[model samples]
Target: MTGFVVRRIGFYTFVAVVLAFFALPLLWLVTAPFTDTPTYEVKVPDFTPANFQAIVEHPYALGSLVNSIILAVGTAALVVLFASLAAYALSRVRLPGRDALLYALLLLSSIITGTAAMVPLFQLAVTVGLIDSQLGLILILTGGLLPAAIFMLKDFMDSTPKSYEESARVFGASPLQIVGHIVVPLVRPGLATIAVWALANVWGNFLMPYLLLSDVEKQPAAVIMYTLYTEGGQPNLRLLSTFGLLYSIPVVLMYLFVSKKYGFRFHGGIKR
Candidate 1:
């Protein structure tokens, strides 16, 4: 009885510490937007929307959010479309060095990150007349993400029954029709997963948009938020916290919506 009680107490204590660690930041995020002169400490907000007004007053604050949405939506659409097609092809076709090809692409993507290739990327963009263009940034981000997205989606594609495709083929459905009408329906979960994942990646991405876009008007929220600091480097915490809370809402809502739609629950994979 003594050991059992001791272990229970220790477990609850650890859980409580973990909960507090996460809860504090969430608490700040929720309360700071409505706060007057927000601070780092978690306290009851004074309940003013002045922080929001202050953010609204900033020239590019709201506009940056629009740009962010464009980038995120564009990138996610491109990634999901290309990744699904590539994954389906890789899953169905037996090719020499197929797995090797996928792994090689993934490995290269990880090693040569956007930051590492920024100079070359910028030069290429300039050569192609895509510098400071949203379409250019979307294409760049899509390329960086495609390898990993395809790799992840391939497992889902493989898990789908090939019998469906065979039946569709018997009906004289074209390859594109089979993919659109047959394969895509069976892999809805994979599509949803990758779409949400891509949105989150592009939404919070700062460095890519920062380097690609030069005009302040063209900048996304991630880049524009950096300018919230005073010239002396003192952060405008009120504006910063408010904008962060607003900035986080779209992705959080997207995750919740997708999870709810797909019934994102798991059963035990490892048995005791």
Candidate 2:
């Protein structure tokens, strides 16, 4: 009885500490936005929405926000669709070199990093005349993000029993029909988790967009946020806080909506 009680107490203490670590910075940011501007100083006992207003009304800032939304949604949808198809094939099909292909994919995924590939990626996009475009960034981000998304969905599909697909096939179902009618339905939770993760990645990416896109109007929120910090002079703490919070709202809302609607099972391995 004493051991069980100690375990419970330790668990609660860990939870509390973790929560505080994550929440404190956000709390400080929220309050900072309300501070007075020009100096962009955080004033005590004074917090207002004026700084947020300035950001929303600014053309560059507002355009960046819109560009972020478009790219995030586009990348998420693309990753989920392509990854789902690839993962389904990997999980369900039997081919001569399927295992070898899967190993190669995993190997390639481990070695590729956006920062390392940035120069070639920029030159390639420039050659294709994709530089300085939202679509260019979207395509580049999607290529890097899809492999991991496929791996995530593949694990989820592996957890499901083969009987599900076998039964569908026995009923005279076509491949497309089986995927559409059986595989996708069983993997809904995993797909939701993948979409949420993909959107978050695209929204937060800075280096690729910063390299390929120079047009202020085509830049995503993360890029603009960096410019606001590094180039716009000494940190305007108030404006910085305000825009940061606003910038985060879309991702936070997505996480909230996804978590509320769907319980995610992200653990590895298939339970027999």
Candidate 3:
């Protein structure tokens, strides 16, 4: 009994410390937006609108917010469409070397590096006239995030009973019907999880947008935040902290929605 009690106490203490560690920076970030010091100092318990107002009232700030939203939504839709198709094909089909194919896909997922193909991808985008466009960023982000989304969706689809498709086929339903009417509805929650993950990645990523888009107005919030770091000839803490807080809301709201809707209890596995 004593050992069990001591273990439980230690676990709770560890959790509490971790929670504080993560929450502290966000807390400081949130409060920083509402108050500002005369220069580069941290203002404690001061309530003023200068920082938040700067982000809210600036034209470039609003444009960055719009670009971020468009990029996130576009990438999310593309991820779901392509990932669902790929997952369905991988899950429902039986073919030669299926195991090998899946293993290859899993390997591909492990090799993703945002910077590995940067130069070539940038050259291709420039060749295709996508340089400095919001669509270009969305396309790159979607392609970058697709592998993991497909892997997860495939596992979720495998968990669904095959009988669902068999039953639909008994009534003369086509493969498209089985997928659209039956499988999709069942795995909506899993797709939501994938969407949340994809959106977070695209929204928070700074490198691809920075390398691809040269127009400041078309850049996402992450790039804008980076600009706040470099464009002023030195680090500006007030603008950085303010934009950081502003940039976080959409992703944070998305996470909260997914947690509320899904409850974090996803059960699915791709079996051999």
By summed lDDT, the worst window of 10 consecutive residues in model 3 runs over: 36-45
Clashing pairs in 1: none
Which stretches of candidate 3 lie above 4 Å from their native place? 1-20, 38-43, 230-233, 267-272
Provide the clash count, candidate 1: 0
Residue 90's lDDT within candidate 3 is 86
lDDT score for candidate 2 against the true structure: 0.81
Per-residue lDDT of model 1, residues 15-72, tens digit only: 9999999999999889978878788888888989889998899999999999999999
Q: How many backbone clashes does candidate 2 have?
A: 0
Instruction: Return the TM-score for candidate 1, rounded to 2 decimals.
Output: 0.94
Model 3 lDDT on a 0 to 1 scale: 0.81
The C-alpha RMSD in Å for every predicted model, in order, reads 3.5, 4.3, 3.8
Identify the candidate with maximal TM-score.
1
Identify the superior model by TM-score, candidate 1 or candidate 3. 1
lDDT of 3 at 151: 82
User: Taking the tens digit of each residue's C-alpha lDDT, what string does model 2 give over 76-186?
Assistant: 899999999999888877889877777777678778789888888888898999988887778888899887788778888887777867898898999989778877777
Tens digits of lDDT, candidate 3, 1-272: 99999999999999999998888777778777766563433447477878777767767887888898999899999999899999999887888997687777767766757788788888889899998888877888888888778887988898888887898999999988988888887788888888888888888889998888888888888878766766557756667777877788877788788788777767433222
